[model samples]
Target: IPQFEDVKFEAASLLSELYCQENSVDTAKPLLRKAIQISQQTPYWHCRLLFQLAQLHTLEKDLVSACDLLGVGAEYARVVGSEYTRALFLLSKGMLLLMERKLQEVHPLLTLCGQIVENWQGNPIQKESLRVFFLVLQVTHYLDAGQVKSVKPCLKQLQQCIQTISTLHDDEILPSNPADLFHWLPKEHMCVLVYLVTVMHSMQAGYLEKAQKYTDKALMQLEKLKMLDCSPILSSFQVILLEHIIMCRLVTGHKATALQEISQVCQLCQQSPRLFSNHAAQLHTLLGLYCISVNCMDNAEAQFTTALRLTTHQELWAFIVTNLASVYIREGNRHQELYSLLERINPDHNFPVSSHCLRAAAFYIRGLFSFFQGRYNEAKRFLRETLKMSNAEDLNRLTACSLVLLGHIFYVLGNHRESNNMVVPAMQLASKIPDMSVQLWSSALLRDLNKACGNAMDAHEAAQMHQNFSQQLLQDHIEACSLPEHNLITWTDGPPPVQFQAQNGPTTSLASLL
Candidate 1:
């Protein structure tokens, strides 16, 4: 029979590997339970097992369970003088609090962890990994606080770690024998960690283009690995990266590329429909946005309904809800329900993102909804708020749309020059970014504005631009539609019957929902 101490220790460590690999909580729960049972006489071992269980709960977003477990683990860690584990527990707890936007509650916990790590200052092998993990949390906290300057030193430390890892020859750096300590670990894990640091640093600097480059490289590395697809560790990280890419693509107005990537993701979700139903809905919501941009009203409505069917995540639903409201206003329908949905999205609080650019876009989208309702004064207020925050290299679509809205608002107030000035800048920005949809809409608005002002030369120029951009976009959509049935339905015109039917029953009509 195996020694009780040895068996308990091995089980505790092995559960982490099992959790990372198969990610079957039930499969690993037995191991954790056994470890906890055996460690009942040892405070340190008991604390460690409890911490692992807490982490499992955290991964599932069961914050209440995770908090209860962490509370117990902290007491044991304090009693056993296991400072390293204790610090880690504190760090994780702080991070959880941070995620819940409990910023004030986390500072003291993080401070305690930082002090412990600083005092234990031996150059131990285990120290490096712990330090890296702790520093990641620290950097993230600073990011959440919007303190870019304070995050620089930690960013530099992370970069230095990346460089140090790179300097070691590949075979010598990582564990060689499967039986050796920390063996069977993929070197690409380190790459992914460093890539995350790079991404955070870029985000702090407001450098979307730079962030995209690093994420793209990381994704390429991830694709080359032959790891099991069922790993929760992999899936969790993959979803975050996909969400980031989708956000960046949308902000930069790379709509066609974003749509292509989203469709590919949807196809993957379809293969294992039950496992990825929520993720599929996210893809559908994104597809709805792409459809709206192209003026495919029917397809856009269908995609939004598909998204609403997928899940009830409040944050994710906000995007679809707001856009569907815009669609309702566009269709000249009564939009009281749409207004109610928008209020539901941000009810009784400021937004959670806290990003000026994102807020500006949200306001600008609302302006579009207001304009469609012919509420010109309300539209101007929201659109001007959008412009006040606008800078170079932000979301071109929002800026373009805002300018178009301003043009319409000024036209309503009979101020043609002010309208023309706004529209001209929008055209310039749209031209630089190559967003065919925005370009088409902006050009059309300018053409009408020029005609209204009796500028024949400007009207002729605007008409030509509108016609050329719209024709090219329509041609591309037709080409993309000429594909397999499993492919995304493209942005072509009026058909009597909708081709793609939902396999799931009784999806709420998005029109009704909006």
Candidate 2:
């Protein structure tokens, strides 16, 4: 009260950031309000303070207020006469929507952000960091929509952006506090974002070995972040890393190991709720899948329910809905929920063919539900549509799963020739992958189909092969699920060497996460 406006604003700003770093946002909020009030007489400080307050609203899950604050921030940016600040605010708004999976509204803001960053004449690091952040945001946009090829250019641009940031002067410092630096994201935070999006891209692009390799790299980078201890951002990334690691394990058939990893991550989340507050949907979804695999229908339903409540993204929520319908179908659906669920999901795509995965999923699940209900013609049609329209590497496993189900539908209908034909290609696709996890169910189908056609010798041989693959799958669980003791994650081109005996362990680059 005794000091000038600038002095009071400076003191209040630093105190707000210190409180935030300590995870004491309650303390920070009041201090920010006071700072905003004091700086109301000055255009720059006032608008910047408004942005800071909006960030607090975002943290509190009050998105309406956050949206209004952005509007207010825009007016202040005009008053302060800073195009860069206005562009930065637009970028921030885009990022918020991006995280919500609101792709349609983000592209315009991102287009403007790229233009602003290109024209910016600020400190080199700040400009470069903004560029990198935009690159990552673009990559995530395409990746989640299942457009892997679209991300190629963005990935190349991201690498160039990162190199540019690294060449900046080390002696210079940028604002680390959100209250003071409402304009741009930090370099460390930018690096983390890039690492995460790239790893996720690898997973969705059908490169399980590459996924494991990058997850390890991202985890190592997360541990080395130069941020506040247990930073909520860092914690958020930790949850995401663990989720992907578990995903890699599951994709490669390490059910026991994946469960172990999930247990460890659940405990970690319990111990640190700040980071994983929004992460339960994925964790529960994975658990539901595992439960379904082992015929734990009731448990699967419960996990899926929890996942549905936690899911915010439409596509992800759609997947859970599909899975939940499958569980209901398995239960014989005395309640008619499966048909209702199926009718509710629209199988049309508006933008980005990447969403074809979700449409394809709807077809596959409907096919299965039809098969379960003894509607053979409807099952065949839905399964055929799934094979034709759902395009993406990540959904390849689901397609393979649908084909095996189709073959069984043929067998149940006494069309032995059709069953054999369907299974042969399915097995071929599954076995082509280095990790045979995708083809696990195919082996059993092949065995049954061989027996159906009177090839008793081939049937017996397939039975042994199926047993050997199953045993090897279980043995690799422990190693696949655990964190690596080293930095390198190795990889090779083809299916790994097979060992028939239990005496020898798994021998593939995908087996080691290190």
CA deviation > 4 Å runs, candidate 2: 1-6, 14-34, 37-44, 78-81, 99-104, 167-186, 226-229, 310-313, 333-335, 346-355, 392-394, 410-425, 432-437, 450-461, 473-514
Among all candidates shown, the one with the greatest lDDT: 2
Evaluated at residue 457, the lDDT of candidate 2 is: 93
Model 1 TM-score is 0.72
lDDT by residue (tens digit), candidate 1, 1-514: 7567867576666866577567577777677867777786665567657777877777677877787777666666656665666666666777688776665777777777778877765334435555666777777766554445567788788667656655545444533221112211244566676686677556434456777888888777667652544544444455556655655565455555665555545544544533364466666676677666556767878878778777565445566766776776676664676676566544225664554444565677778777877888888888887776554324455677788779768877889888889878877876665445567877887898889988899999999998987777766566434323223644222211122323454432244356
Candidate 1 versus truth, CA RMSD in Å, comes to: 8.0
- Total backbone clashes of candidate 1, pairs 3 or more residues apart or in separate chains: 0
